[model samples]
Target: MVGAGIGGLCAAAGLQRAGVEVVVLERADEVRSGGSGLSVFSNGIRALDALGVGDAFRAVTTRTEGLRAGQRRPSGAWLSTLPADAVAELRVIDRADLHGLLSDAVTAGTVRTGRRVTSMYPNGLVESVGSGTAGARRAWDRFDLVIGADGLRSAVRTGWPEDPGVAYSGYATWRGITAAPVELRGEAGETWGVECRFGIAPLADGRVYWFGVRTAGIDEPGDPALLRELFGSWHRPIPELIDATDPAAMQYLPIEELSGDLPTFARGRAVLLGDAAHAMTPDLGQGGGMAMEDAATLVGLIAPFAGTECGDAPELLDEALRRYDELRRPRPQRVAARSRMIGRLAHAPGPLLCAARDLVVRATPAAALGRQAAWVHEWLLTR
Candidate 1:
């Protein structure tokens, strides 16, 4: 396994629980400690259950059950309010908490921090650079499989044959967690404007996780004041949420996703998973959900190979991997495409288009919107 993000760690944990030896290679000196927030939808929750970490996740995350969630205008009037019953399974989570849970699930010493995977091959060979040692690279081999769970610019995916590259989504975000909890006024969801957005959701603790997004150049300045300038006057808690954040800890990122779908997620003995395979816009809040589903599905499919006594172990491994690619590819790519389309519509530029978009949003019934979203959130773990 390369990269130790949610997907990679989840795969490692599941693989270990199946009695398979696992190793996780991460470039960072330590498992990344903290992050602002992540949205885990219903499908993601079910994937967690399939992975056996459902309870651990629930203990640390706050369910969005009773919160009035949906789209809103900059003035704070609801364009559409999602039905409470429709969104009952959604959860707002602090990334660090979820990371800690997956990290703990893996067997101790399984993750080799600071061991960066430089390259991998179909023959299950991994070339890595370890900390110190004059940056000496070592080649490790003899594995039946290699999983690339690295993020958007995955080395494994980049090294895959006919790699299609990634594209900028033309929007950027400033994400932060408040130093202290700010009063939410009993609401959680996104506030959308022309070419921009602001989101607010509570963590299990009182601190709130919020983000401000703007359609901007990929290299837009990471100015802490930009958020206030963009959202200070919009709504009551949006400004207050900004004020409660620590300037030094704010995170700025330009959203990007895979440029195009790969012909296959498999190359030789290696497979691509998570953002490494099909990075999509977070407009649907399904990015993390897709990753979790990928991890669970792959782990489940390959479990029988863990201690196979059959002489055709290699054949079984090959079949399972082939099945993984066949079963997993279409859904996520479709989700990514749908998310990209939503991002474009939400960020429609100028007055006329924005007005039309808002009108459509207001006209759409809440239950109808929920029904449209049901397909994305209705997945269960499959073996």
Candidate 2:
């Protein structure tokens, strides 16, 4: 495995648990120490359970009670109310916390840091930075299987260019966690307004995780004051959250979604997972959760073929990749389209469109909402 991000770590966990000798190569000196937070939906937890880390995750996370969806009016009146079940089986946690958990579970000597994978071949061979003495040449190592769990800008993906690079979603997101004096009453909530959206949830600690997004054509400016100025007046607790944020800790990035064409996941003995396979917008907080699912699925697919005919490995891997694409593609595409549509509706030009959209949200039954997400949340890898 190359890239020690969440996807790589999870894949390593699954493969190692199945008695596979796995070596994870990471370019960074260490795991990412700082990231905002991630929502671990029930499906993601189930995937962790399959890997035997679900209980540990639960111990360090907080289960969301419910979600409060509303729309803010130009005059500051909340014109919408869509109360969702708090016990929707979704939990939220800091990225660093989850990374620590996975890192701890990994067997010693399986993960090598600061080793950059410079290139890869069709065969099961990869070249990475080797130890050198006084400018002497170094040596590279070979593995049976190379899993590319690298993130969106994956070097493996670049090595074997697949679909045209990542597609920009015309919007950017700013994420930060802040101390909250009041406890969050529900799981999480989102407030949508014209071309702007704000979401907040309480973490296991007393801090609240919040993300503010707006449709912008350019790269994020990465200024805390700008985030404050844009979303300061959205609603109660928003400005408070912003004020409580450490200016230096705020992170910003433009949202980008990968095109769903071609089979770039596996070329011969190498395979790609997580964001390397499909990186969608965060309109739905399933990005990390989906990656977790991909890890588990990939492990299951490969475990059945261990020690099989060497000639069959490529065919088996291809079948697994196809199944992965079949199972993961539709749901994430739906989520991406839903997120984009919601953004459009939230940023509608006239009051009439906004009113209509709010009406649909209000009229939609909570049970129906749950059913809409059932296909995603109720997924079980056991089947």
Error of 2 at 361 (Å): 3.3
Which stretches of candidate 1 lie above 4 Å from their native place?
Answer: 131-134
Q: All candidates' TM-scores?
A: 0.97, 0.87
What TM value does model 2 have?
A: 0.87
Candidate 1, position 58, lDDT: 89
* Alpha carbon lDDT of each predicted model: 0.87, 0.73
Relative to the unseen true structure, what is the C-alpha lDDT of residue 143 in candidate 2, on a scale of 0 to 100? Answer: 72
Summarize candidate 2's per-residue lDDT along 1-383 as a digit string, tens digits. 98888888888888888778888887776677564988887889988987768888999987655555444553445555444542357787888889999998789888887777778876867877742321223447777677887788777777885645778877788898884444555424677666677888778787888888887876547577787677877657777788888878888888887755445456777777777777777766778887888788777877787657677776776787667666755655566577666666665655576667777776777666666566557768831
Residue 87 shift from truth in candidate 2, angstroms: 5.0
Tens digits of per-residue lDDT, candidate 1, 15-76, equal 88887889888888888756488888889999888888988998887676788988998898
Pairs that collide, model 1: 122-268, 122-269
Candidate 1 matches the true fold with a TM-score of 0.97
For model 2 the local lDDT of residue 280 reads: 76
